[model samples]
Target: MITADKFLIPARELGFNFFTGTPCSYLKPFINYVIDTDGFDFVDSVNEGDAIAIAAGATVGGKRAVVMFQNSGLGNAVNPITSLTYTFNIPVMIITTLRGEPGGPADEPQHELMGQITTAMLETMRLKWAFFPQTEEEVAPALKAADEYMKKHNQPFVFVMRKDDIAEYKLQKKPAASKKDFSITHTDHFELDYKARTTRTPVLEVLQKSVALSAAVIATTGKTGREFYEVGDQKNQLYMVGSMGCALAFGLGLAMVKPKLKVIVLDGDGALLMRTGSMATAGAYKPKNLVHILIDNEAHDSTGGQGTVTGGVSFGTIAAGFGYDKIYSTDRLEKFSEIVEEVKKNDVVTFVHMKTQKGSPEKLGRPKVTPAEVSVRFAEFVQSK
Candidate 1:
């Protein structure tokens, strides 16, 4: 067996310094090693799928990220792995432990079937994976192969670790950013009819003008991104074509790695409500550079104007409860722009909720650029500074 450092040190040297995962017993040593190391970030995620989305965000922000989990939970990660990461051409490293090796050991019944089909499942997903390195000499070559494949394909690579592959390493101290003692603080409520308020189009317009040229704007799927693309397209803007509710987490991941850049997430009510858990994840990380903008038209405007429950929902209060340091909500366009300028200068994670009317331009067009092309240009822009 090899020490966890045997592979991780090299990975870190190669700039894979961000890590997130849902833990497994076999991952104890490796996960502990990553947490104990300085300059490496390890966020214990709520689930495997969200972990992948977070890594995708970090990858988009020009930082290589690694995610670790149990092989059995790979099923939980399929959606984002296929839709979000694959669709956007984001590359990340996945280290999953094999719990029930076929015919090698008698283990828990739950892990047996998963182990039998793990390798095959990965192949089906078109993920090229290698057995996790077992010795000091094997680590370098394994990592090199992963690095080359990820760089070439701009997609995820995997290392399937087996039982006892890593020698035990005890965590020396409580990690500096270890889970904290926390509580949610709700925002003050305000009743307003967005019918008399601004619509989605001008909100995009104001955002296009307020942020710096170097700032990155990640708009959620559906009409929100379409409207932004219609307003203006730039290298700094990434119009998320799929993975509907992942925009905020994606923006959070980017903000975490590239803290100097202003990263704004334009999320819609339907999308935000779909993945409400992501708000907690974003709030937990609390990246000062991230500005989460939720525009509530109280409907899924892209899908025949179906109404959402956001009319009675106060997202600013919910975001505050999730731990955003600053919260702003507006029914007026001028007030929204003022909050944008104010939050741009505030060194804290902030949330802006805008009440808008349900409507778009008569001819709002989809982004002309393909998904891969958008990803490449966005990556280049993120790395330029």
Candidate 2:
């Protein structure tokens, strides 16, 4: 039997000592070893996207980060994987535990599809990855190769683990905080230069407006994602890019997969405009659980603020037409807050529209948690349902 602890020492040697992820039964042995170790830094992320972002940020800061998650969390990590880190040249190590290898045994229905596509999806992203080493001796070299790819190419790498590879180990205390604390300065702020005569600003202000109201927030692709993450509690929120208005779609998936969680999808005019079909989908599903907030800035702000259909179209009318149980609109913060509060009482999908400015953050940083941490926390979060 391989001793998981020994493989970890090589991880330390390779300068990939920091770890984060959600635990999969397929990865439990390795997860236990990590949690039980004293020298590694492991964070419990809310989901795979959050973990991927965290690791991306850490990679930019000159630390190698590894994210472990189940094959299922791939759907959550896809946007950021392609848009944020890949577009920006940030490198991270990802490890996914394979579940439901056919004929090995009968597994849960949920894991079957994930098992089939986990590796293929990684390839679709063109990520350099490896499976868990069959022998403990191979772990060091495999990790070394992964680290080299990250440093040389500025692209993400992955290490897929199998059930047989990871064995149980004692939980370890989290490593002490590293000596250096890095903070990102925002050079780009999508702001409204002209102060509004009324309390309301443009629809983009919905994110800041929501945070001000202490409402849980999420941001979609492009500037909306960056601005929301920039303004909200970085640790609690989820953001995506290149999904191009599929924010609600992802949010719906999260809501359905995790029923008890109160999910708020911070969608933009362009994104919602692209995936308007989701509105009907959501209406049909009747996820009484989600509040779909559309920030109708009326322009593709990230893509140079091009005018959108919402400029002449009424989003509020659209929401009502689409069968939203409750619909609200506001150009002012006070009105925004009041409408959100009123909508809180409804047990159906609610839509909120706000006007925002056409500006993007100057610099963007990805999340720091590894893929692993996100899966672990997300699953735990879901289970708490």
Candidate 3:
């Protein structure tokens, strides 16, 4: 068996220093080593999908990232893997443990089917993968091949790890104490007149003009991105297409890696509700350069205006509960613009919940720029000073 450092040291030398993933028994030694090491950064994501999105964000910010998770949770990561990484051509290394290896070891009944199909599932996703290096000599060649593939294709490469591939390494770091003094403050002024409330177009116009040129903007899927693109496409903007709920997590990753660059997420109510757990991760890390702006129209506007559960939900309370450093709620466009300006002046994780009318500009169209093109330019924009 190989020591965790044998693989990790070289991986770090090759620029894979940022790590994020959910915990797994097979990954204990590898993760422990990263946590204990001073040069590495490890983010404990709430789910495997969030892990992927975060890693992708880091990759976009010019950091080589590695995501680790168990095979059982691989299913949870498929959506972002296919939509976010594949569609955007963002490469990040993925190390997934083999929980239920056939004829290797008897595992829980739950891992049986997943174990049997783990490699098959990777193949189905069109992800290039290899069995993880088990011996000291195998480590270099394995990493070289994976690195070469990722650099060539600009897509994710997987390493399916068997149990006990790395020697045991204990964690020496202690978890940080929780902050008890922080409190949520809201500035709710929801206008009862729905007709008088501003629509998405005007809000996007304000945002396009308000945010600085160097700041990176991540627009969530569906109408939010479409409307933002329609308002004006900027080099600093990344329009997410298929990854519906990953904008905040992506922004979190970018914000963490590129702390000097402002990362703003344009989120929709339906999308935010789909991956609310990401907020918990944001709260925990509390990246000071990140800004979350939610335009809650209370309906799935892109999907034929189906009413969502957000009408009864108070997102300001939810953001507060999730540990956002700043929370503001407003329905008026002027107030929303003021909140955006205010958040830009602060060095804290902020959330703005804006209640807007439920319609887009008539005949709204998708961005002419392809997802791949957008990602390439966005990564360049992110890495630029």
Best by lDDT: 3
What TM-score does each of the candidates earn?
0.92, 0.52, 0.97
Candidate 2 lDDT over 1-385, as tens digits, reads 3677777778767777666567777677677777776766665555676567656544433456778898788887887788766765667788887787655567789889888888888899998888778786787788778878888987888888766776666555565574365343212112343234122123435445544433334577666655554454343355564646556655654554344556677787887776576676566556677889876667777777678877566766666656677777666555666766666666788888766545555675554544344333433443454
Q: If both were scored by lDDT, which would come out higher, candidate 1 or candidate 3?
A: 3
**Best TM-score among the predictions, by candidate number:** 3
lDDT of 3 by residue, 62-137 (tens): 9999999999999999999999999999999999999999987788999999999999999999999999998889
Measured with C-alpha atoms, the lDDT of residue 170 in candidate 3 is 93
Note the Cα lDDT for every prediction shown.
Answer: 0.87, 0.65, 0.92
The lDDT, on a scale of 0 to 1, for candidate 1 is 0.87
lDDT of 2: 0.65
**For every candidate, C-alpha RMSD to the true structure in Å:** 2.4, 14.0, 1.4
lDDT digits (tens) for residues 70-112 of candidate 1: 9989997887888888988889999988988897767899998
* Residue 123 lDDT, candidate 2, scale 0-100: 93
Q: In candidate 2, how many Å is residue 323 off?
A: 34
Off by over 4 Å in 2: 170-385
Tally clashing residue pairs in candidate 1: 0
